[model samples]
Target chain A: MAFPPFAVTVDLVVFTIRDDQLCVLTIERGEAPFAGGQALPGGFVLPDEDLADAAARELAEETGVGKDAELERVHLEQLGTYGDPTRDPRMRTVSVAYLAFAAQLSEPIAGTDAAAAQWMPVASALTTSLAFDHGQILADGLERARAKLEYTTLAATFCRDEFTIADLRHVYELVWDVTIDPRNFHRKVLASEGFVEPTGEQTSQGRGRPAQLFTRGDATQLHPPIRR
Target chain B: MAFPPFAVTVDLVVFTIRDDQLCVLTIERGEAPFAGGQALPGGFVLPDEDLADAAARELAEETGVGKDAELERVHLEQLGTYGDPTRDPRMRTVSVAYLAFAAQLSEPIAGTDAAAAQWMPVASALTTSLAFDHGQILADGLERARAKLEYTTLAATFCRDEFTIADLRHVYELVWDVTIDPRNFHRKVLASEGFVEPTGEQTSQGRGRPAQLFTRGDATQLHPPIRR
Candidate 1:
């Protein structure tokens, strides 16, 4: 029996927020087809692993989300597939792109086929040419993150487990790149049931009086979504 | 140099509303692996076509949405990828699933390898055994449709170009399997800016009175989403 002439690859658009800016994990390709250019950290799927497993494995190898991985702290989801026949010059390849978000990450460790890895600010990365169709994948990942914040508790993934309302608002401000009315943001978040629950503790981190700490609630979809 | 060991396929979960229920297009497989069983209308990606192009072609072939295709009227989007190495019995295959919605689609015409094609209510299709991992794909598609209704102008796709408030509410009720308060639904939908625009026409379709006509608006994402 003749096998279908095709190849499957997994790409990760890992996102993080550092220095009040949204950043994406990128690697310098050590091989041809845009060699030395920055690209999302990813690789071909193994015959024995699931697509998501391949994505996580590639993420671990490219970044350092290794064995001690606080997997739950990371929000990982399938972004979409990019399968333009001419996307890869060598062969007909279909790539399954994944979206991952977590708290600020340290520098990444390059894989065998990567020259180096680092977290690039989303703004700077969008202007640079990325390998293959990775630029499109990064754009889609960023949009997904922005949209998800409206209806899902995904924003919490970018913060520590215990955070104040201001800490959460900063996540929104940084990702959306807008300064929101702190009082309005706090009111909306508190009114949206299952969005967050007060921890009965306060944090004296930023200016003004200490703010109450809170954790993500049980709700996945917010009833009245916080509009962007 | 070695090629990646995998085949790429596209599976479409085409949905529509008919007889007050959400329906899915399904085909009976005429080939082995799961012969005589029902499956989503799809096939392996052709070497020369883009992933989405291949999906649209397969859709046209299996359901006769051919050339003069009302492609613009249909809302088609990539759902996600399913690649459990063992999901396919023949070889390691990665399948990209797509979700398509249109005004009530006619009975499907079977393609070369399908024995028959029919529009099955999503409720019934969920309980029936489908070939491969198609059952899971259908479920995901249904959920995507349900969720998209909350934050997008997608509900308009289910109605005719000019429709009444009752017609729009029915689409939501059918997909969500809930009875929404007609008064509240009308107020909420109208309150959301750019959700639907009045067309200066009325139709007495079902009963009672001739309702005002409206068409889909310019907005894609609803600012203050009409939450379910």
Candidate 2:
């Protein structure tokens, strides 16, 4: 019966595999709450927009990603909600955090009054100071990404449309931050039915033998997870 | 700088195993916006409460689980946030759904103006009508519970403090809605270190044998998940 004294926002932990490193898109907030501090790209959800739509809009606004490009190339899902009563200094703000992944990204052009926008490696981002509870949100999102890779075909989302087994393996290594056995990794990935299918064409990466290319298959849940 | 136009609420999907079936707690709404419809036990979150605290509070209020007992025995986690703009007829509301599990539970007593509250078999509840986006939330919660059993020792949360391997298997069978081989189930559960530990006691069920009792262990995740 009383007016709800709370606010809803959407924050995105937009991740990408770039140059053999796992990076997330972050912006330097231009507002009073931790102004000039790095934070996940996000803003308040509009009254009429869906949660996912708000996240996608904020992602485009902060990263300058074209709407079409974002819709076609990015994968987003609800991560979790954070409402700690005092999470926001201005009001009781409950943020629905989203986990997103994209293959490749260019330098960001800051929008929506963000002082700066750029891609920061997950490792460094974890160490850098962030606004509000964005630090914990980033940590949770990274763990989700790592755990998802073990049992889901999401790793392929971080690679080019046409990539080799090595390319897929690198995504795991970068995200998990571990050196997996190449032979074992190759064998398991190929054996996992509907995980990846060969393109029948091989591309030489250097002087060595040309590695066969493959694309993501239809499988969503891996039966035998690729353990870390 | 504008006031956030969204209202925040919490919905709980509390699951329990009873009579060889997985049941979820549901309450009949006592007010408009689908009044008298069966729904997951939930209400508007109070302003000063944390999200999880709000879920815990609502769980206790609607189900009559004592605060201390609920805090100790229940395992709760953020399932996901549902914000479809039109989910609530009153205004723009974003409900943070929570997934919870309890060992053995008694009949629920409706509280806080709920018309009635009771535990209903998940299968039957799925077919029955529910208020708001609760049906979708229930589906997601059920899938999460089923998947969690594969890798986490969460099934133990559905058993008594000290239970037999057969009792544990029944929890799996009931939640997954699939019968598992007794021998294979026992072997896999024990072999998975940190899944359960002997309690140095035994209990007799019906006219069968006296089975050894075991308690949940420290291990959170199984290396090789028990496949369904």
Candidate 3:
């Protein structure tokens, strides 16, 4: 039986922490269907390209980041797929959405199909009307990131290679939009096995004593999850 | 830029517990590509239909179940999407996979494209070489179901509307293939707030004294998760 033809695309939600706030990478559409409107940095999936590779390529093209170097520190995974019949106006399209977490990233450069590319604070971005179903997609990505932080060690991806527990707590605080007690967070981080490994190094936040440094551990999941 | 045309399809991995063993629904293909081989129940998405609607339609058609009645008791969610350039020999097909859980489903009847439809033990199904990357899809669905059971109250979907705590425990033991201590399991389930609600009813199992009956609770996620 003949089936309806579809045009598959990949959309990205690349998130990073900057200025103590969570920001997402977005592009200003240069083409029709939402010209001059904000949208996630992504494009059509090449016929032979793998879904993940397509996401990486789009990330590199839109942000001017080298796939090899930048992706080394980025934690990328499939968020979900969006295929509402009326989601896209051009034609029958199915978009596979991916979520990525990275530490402080460099400035972005606009791609061919984008008028501009830049980081937008998630709070303000939610208020602005985004192109297509991107507003819903971005909201879903944020929720996934927040929930994963409760049981996974992914928050470490938002910090430098060597960071103090305070730096890590700031990541959770900013992303979750909550103030977590430093003392309680420290105790819980230490109790969860393989959550962090001490680097035996020390660093000081201005006006504070030197604090021990640590790096992400091998365990990807925390047994006794830190509740949100 | 012109992109290669693609066909999008939906595949299902419906799972249930029967006779103390976890089983999955599968069908034998009636057409070429993998004629007479075992496969999941699914079909191509209609031009104007929603992705989820396509999945539910396929499930109902292949299983001979009414969409309204059967879907009321089934827990269905998107598992993931698969799109290897060479996954399908005839065309470039991208399949969105779905996973479902039901309680004591009725016997399945064959659909138009299927020569036969029935339940197969998950253990044996894994050993059989299923048509088109289905083996990998099945494994992924199984893993998702097992992990969700750890944190979600979805395991109750495999039990009757009113069941004893032992029935719930059995669902876990059979799916995880692990032997959990009965007393410890009982205490943990009750301690997890809103995991289950008492029905003020009792039922007898064999020669054992009457056991209190309960139904699924309002909570979806379990705190201090029932660790695997």
Q: Arrange candidates by lDDT, descending.
A: 3, 2, 1
Clashing pairs in 3: none
Name the regions of candidate 3 deviating beyond 4 angstroms: B191-194
State interface RMSD in Å for all models. 1.3, 1.2, 0.8
Model 3 agreement with the true structure over A32-75: per-residue lDDT tens digits: 78998999988898988888888888887877665567677788
**Residue-wise lDDT of candidate 1 within A166-224, one digit each (tens)?**
88899999888889999999899999898889999998876789999999899888777
Worst 10 residues of 1 chain A by lDDT: A104-113
Residue A158, model 1: lDDT of 91
Better of 2 and 3 by DockQ: 2
Computed on alpha carbons, the lDDT of every model, listed in order, comes to 0.86, 0.87, 0.89
TM-score of each: 0.92, 0.96, 0.94
Candidates 1 and 2, the one with greater DockQ: 2
- lDDT per residue, candidate 2, B1-228, as tens digits? 676667788899999987778999898888898988899988788878898988888988877675565567678999999999899888888899999999776665657877888889999999998999999999999999999998898999898788999999999899998889999888898899999999899887688788889999999888678878
- In terms of DockQ, which candidate is strongest? 2
